[model samples]
Target: MGHDKSGINNELFFGEKNAFSKKYEAILYNESKALSPSAKVYFNQINAFLAMKKGKADLAYTHMQRIRVLYSWYPEIKENNYNEYLRSNRNLCIVLMHQKRFEEATEVIDQLQKP
Candidate 1:
């Protein structure tokens, strides 16, 4: 039988947190070798999420820097996928807040609120 999408979603939703780490890491490592610009942004975001989850604020910030660098070359991100961008931005803001970088977190939130 084919893989069950619902089962995969359920596992992702409520199973072990690191359940997808290996897959994500492999994809990220391979993508890094290929240097796919789009993949780099996603890899950085996933790394940042993992770092944040592990209470590694500094590492998360470094990954966030990668994202910022990627975004700097494309200022029209808000017009591309505003909802997804806002979601990712919000997650970063939360991580920054955990690290007590209130100013930076506030800036992200402000940007997300903009039209």
Candidate 2:
């Protein structure tokens, strides 16, 4: 997804049906009897997007980076959640690119392509 101003604005909901990202996020966190590790990872991913929408690129980068650490909590996560792993990496690379950190973005790409 491109970081266009209109895109972010369109993603924001004004009324009902999960008014704010964090409100839904708290439901995701507290309503569950036991929050899954994978769910936490997803929260970070969504938070990253929300951060970007709010023009907090630095915080967005932090959230994306946290995905990797969360995955490490369970050895099989990267293997089982392969798609999400790639997605998070891809988003991280995007943030890096936006910051003009081409080298780091390339490194992430190289890592993503490894067998």
Candidate 3:
């Protein structure tokens, strides 16, 4: 599904909390790889967001890791452009903080300071 039809904004803003969010996230994850990489990144981001909304910090971290790995790979070259996943890192910090992992959260936050 395209961004216009992804329903991400609607679900985040209007949809009530319930079991269906997991089903929706699962559907996105199950989509064929023919979906562009960037779109997959967005879908994983949505997964992390929904997981956090449901207080599933561990699952959200997993989603963030997936996005991070994808962003670290270069399409035409081999390089780890880690900053490309800074949003995911921020989300990771949030998730860690929610889990009461203060030290780990600080470590994740420190990544933002890298120049």
Candidate 4:
């Protein structure tokens, strides 16, 4: 499934708070990856989500950076799934701020402002 069809939204909207512990969302995302390698792109979001939820902003930023590399390697993915990329950038900015990287976060904010 593509990003739109992924279960991420379902989990976020309907899953219990306790059910989210122990990297549960990431594990479910991994199972989807096993069924469809194409879903790997979404894993970037999942990893970042788990990292940020655990208060590990550095790790979350790393995951966002990794997704940047992936997008660079596959521009079509970036173009086709721009919403996911935007969400990743938003997460990147948040994590950067959490890490006290104000300038970098501002740069990301600037980039987001461009068409």
RMSD of each: 6.1, 4.8, 7.4, 8.0
After superposing candidate 4 on the true structure, give the runs of residues whose Cα lies further than 4 Å from its correct spot. 1-38, 112-115
Candidate 1 regions with alpha-carbon error over 4 angstroms: 1-20, 76-78, 112-115
Worst 10-residue lDDT window for candidate 2 reads 9-18
Q: Give a tens-digit lDDT track for model 2, residues 3-71.
A: 356665354452233366555665534424337777778778777887786778898898888787887
| Local distance difference test scores for all models | 0.68, 0.75, 0.67, 0.70
Best by TM-score: 2
Q: Tens digit of lDDT per residue, candidate 4, span 18-107?
A: 555545655644535434323555676777877776667887787788777777787787788778778778878888888999999899
Tens-digit per-residue lDDT, 37-112, candidate 1: 5567778877787676566889888888777777667656535755756666777787788888999888887865
Model 4, residue 4: C-alpha shift (Å): 26
- TM-score for each prediction? 0.64, 0.73, 0.62, 0.65
Off by over 4 Å in 3: 1-27, 31-34, 75-84
Error of 1 at 18 (Å): 5.4
lDDT of candidate model 4 versus the reference? 0.70
Better of 1 and 2 by TM-score: 2
Clashing pairs in 4: none
Sequence-dependent TM-score of model 3: 0.62
In each prediction, how many residue pairs overlap at the backbone (N, C-alpha, C within less than 3 A)? 0, 0, 0, 0
Which residue pairs show collisions in model 2?
Answer: none
